[model samples]
Target: MNSLTHSSTSVVRKASRFLLTSRRFCDTSRINGDEETLKITWETSEMDCGFAEEHEKISVRRTFLESTKLSASQVLDTLKQDCPGFNTKLALDELNVPISGLLVREVLLGILRRLSFDNKTRCAKLAYKFFVWCGGQESFRHTANCYHLLMKIFAECGEYKAMCRLVDEMIKDGYPTTARTFNLLICTCGEAGLAREVVEQFIKSKTFNYRPFKHSYNAILHSLLGVKHYKLIEWVYEQMLEDGFSPDLLSYNVVMFASFRLGKTDKLYRLLDEMVKDGFSPDLHTYNILLHHLATGNKPLAALNLLNHMREVGVEPSVIHFTTLIDGLSRAGKLEACKYFMDEMVKAGCTPDVVCYTVVITGYISGGELEKAEEMFREMTVKGQLPNVFTYNSMIRGFCMAGKFKEARLLLKEMESRGCNPNFVVYSTLVNNLRNAGKLLEAHEVVKDMVEKGHYVHLISKFKKYTRS
Candidate 1:
């Protein structure tokens, strides 16, 4: 065998040994601690998904409150009406209302939500003034949610310094800094394209005395992965090892993902070997990472072999495992192979979900196989898998790519008929493709529809720029 094959074989053997021996090294105390940390990790991840949803729900729930003597909406309106421009503090100081001790958590949150809706820094300042005013009240103390909300505003408005100050204040005030807070700071900063700053904050956590969780390094690394900061993740992993923190299964999976993302294949294998030697076994996430790397690296056979090995180790391959492989294959332009694996997924008793179908459809579309894309789209529907906004967007984009404007429009109508309302992407795809095809009138219609449907009304001005004489 070639050196690469030999090396791979050796890693596989070590992995096998690692998997078989991992149970023997399970320390009860450590396992309990790790489980609790893992629970926090899972909650943080769940919160990330539900963050926007929960925000919307909160806003909606308080939209029409019962007419109390002084309602939240009335207070918010008073603030907006009186606090014109940036003179929020001045306006609040002059207001002859007993605002202190009257505002509950819900009221405070509602007011903050209203202020944050515009997502302007000026608005954040107004929100912060109100927040400070409330804090100064003898009868009122900000809840953890209140601090998180205000911090979110600051982070969203790029007021990192203000956000950090708030974090320091939270710690100083002896509020329990939970995993949610840690995730919020990292994710919001990362989303704002300040991933490096997240890493910097994590590195400076000791300096700031900002250790939220016992597994702070792992939490930071995991949060960084969510934001796709592969290089930062690897750097943090290095820092973790330097700080004498042993790599857990999650840490290994995270660093392995980083290595895969960075294209450090050799280093990835070496890390696997090291993990095995360290008595860590490959979990489902580990297998998924390896599957993604192997398949996307155009080594489908090796990926399949790995899948077999996974089964041999009594690890059931989930739909996610199959989807990861299919996605990687699709990325590698192996559409046929993707289909083969899709079949294999079903044969292995895992039914393909909309995401799985979407990946394959997207693959066919990207490869310019529009007919195959259409076939798969139909097949998914026949299999009772309704195309989501993403699937519809993919098909619509495919249709537009082939200059089939009529078909794309029909698909848009079909999306609405099927209760899949076209989102910003679907509308933008149509407008852009129609405009590019010189169907200016059609593009204008799509934009008008988009505005009427309450999506990107501001895009009208931008669209006009391109359409102008």
Candidate 2:
């Protein structure tokens, strides 16, 4: 066969192989509900590939250069003016601006970015119309970035079905569905609080041959973890196993954290054992997860023993491991255990960072041991660990809780002098506490200071209402 014919045959063979594999997976997998979607995806892929091959044969002019009189900003403004309503198709038909390839990409991206901030459903509708209009242009082809931007806009507007349709359109256009694409979809869906939907989409993506990562299941799990959808993580992990995908280290760590967060302690230990049997040694993250679980479960001795086990396994605990243990202990009200681990962390040749010190300080403050909290604050400062905003906020809050308004005000100034700018939380802490303590005058002064410093000026009206009431 000729080279072109051979290449075409090879592509067909590959597509056929993909179809066969997908069928096998569908037949054996519990995702039988997606059988129709998988069939449609395969048929669409075959059709798109055939169309692409034919188009390549006939299309000789790949690049189009047109002199557009309008700038990108001008086109954007025109679209914004004409396409602000839901009748985007009518507005697009009326749009007479000349568009180049560069102009279309730039305008589409700009429009999406602007609309992302606005997050209006109308904006999504208008943007989609513009996207369709651009795709219809002879000189303009939708780039992956354009699709991604539009997808993100749709996601922000809570138009998830529209977003998934864009993915389908991308696939039909023969665009490589990359890891970035999958991650974007997962993250946006997670941000929309559609954790279960994220999993469903992931499974559907797999059926449609949208394999972005080498281990796509782990990628979805990791993204779910980013949004703290622990319950979904557990569910997805279980689905991953049922589909015969082996759990990697990342998978184990993610599921372990999910199990820990969900209080499935029995399942957590079982997975730990399974991990060892599977010949995967617990890394630092695994150790930290166990440390957190043990400390939070009020098993201080077990936590210490796990730290020893980590060292025995040649995985030396870092400051983060110690901090996790300490934070868990603090939450469990094991203040003395927190202190002991803080010391042990230093002796293990891992110097405590600011986070380590902050956790301990926050712990003491929460325990109502203001003296110990103050001592930690001073100790961290003296030991050259300059307090961060969180550290200062913890101290300021402790003072406010103890009704030491004067000292709290001094600490606020001290933080600024020490080159730490108080954040919204710091200012809010003072204002809310002072107002609650009936120190309306003091709270008003703080509000004025916050406004003068260009921090949360919008809160001024709310503070006024609080004071008046």
Candidate 3:
């Protein structure tokens, strides 16, 4: 029979049993005997279980799953006392219910409690397992907690993309999330391939009553620059302005760098003017980015102008800023200007690091000035900055280019003795230099060595097309 028919039958049987049970305790008394029989029957018929109440009880049990009485602290303490470096999965299985709520605070505090490991990444992995349990249960509240915790773990561990996914899930679940949550989501999106989702989701969330925070706007702005979405970046800037939030230095930097990438150096300068007009004091990074554009771009004059402007504005140039300027001048074939930056770099009380020496050494090598390059290399060693592969490679290439093959071969041997294996460029240089010196057999031997050492060696290849016959 169908369920409804079976249920009706059961109800009839229950009503009959209630009538049979009540008849023993009741009597058809002297007065109104027929009416009393009717009244007793009606009372017995009315004695029924309320189906709505039973259904509601069943629903409450099914939906909430008997929420655990265990606090997170209690769970953690029990796990620590029992497992003590053992995975919590084994311990969780032994528990009747799971922990949930305020995931960020719990996870951050939990990790801090287990700060014994040197690496500390294992703690995050454990956190991952805990959250996976929460997700599997499909408990929105608990799942939200897990997502929140995962965001923190991903943020601290620099797994930006994973954090973004968690935020997306939280949004989809219709949780009343915070601006900080969305900001982190945007940042994580910035680092990953699916960065555009951050912006789209943020805009969509406006219907849910969230206005863009500074971090939200900044995240989208920064991410746009990452993917070179120039058009959208401008659109976002306009949107931010309309939202009543002024774009800050960070926004300007992204726009400037994006302009630089698009070969719009003039536009980048114009943007810089906008930045100044907005009363945003250009920070060190702003100057650094501009210096990078000037130094790396085909505009040494613009770079020099920026350097002068920086000095006038009292923004002291660090070793890195000077390095970029020096390297840029060298790349532009302005050796004297390069040396001038180096001198000023030292005079400004920023001591040159190995990077500075390497730049100048590379410049000399590119100019085919072997003697000056070697002099700089030796000077770096004398100043107690140990020579790295870059230092050795620069000197070796300089020797090879100057047609000093004998010195190049000796340097190669010295490199090997010092545990520095010659890379592709070094091998190619040796082979080509030997071939040009009329030592074809030696060239072949070097090619064989490169193959055995797993270095790429195309005998007919050119390191520079100018070197080939």
Candidate with best lDDT? 1
Top candidate by TM-score? 1
Error (Å) of candidate 1 at residue 287 is: 0.4
lDDT of 3 at 429: 69
TM-score of each: 0.80, 0.73, 0.49
User: Can you give the lDDT of residue 273 in candidate 3?
Assistant: 73
lDDT of 3 at 4: 43
Residue 443, model 3: lDDT of: 71
How far in Å is the alpha carbon of 61 misplaced in model 1? 13
Instruction: Give the RMSD in angstroms, all C-alphas superposed, for model 2.
Output: 20.5
Query: What lDDT score goes with residue 235 in model 1?
Result: 84
lDDT of 1 by residue, 1-469 (tens): 3755654565456557656545565465766777989988999999987998998888875753333335545556656664447565555556534543335444556654554335466667666777887787665678878888778777667787787688778878877665567677777766667767756665666532235435778777777787688988888888888989998888888898899999998898888888888888788888888888878887777777777788899998999999999999999999989989999999999999999999999999999999999999999999999999999999999999999999999999999998888877888888888988899888887776777778765555656454422
Which should have the higher lDDT, number 1 or number 2? Answer: 1
Which portions of model 2 show Cα errors greater than 4 Å? 1-72, 83-119, 133-143, 176-193, 207-213, 413-421, 452-469
Which scores greater on TM-score, model 1 or model 3? 1
Model 2 earns a TM-score of: 0.73
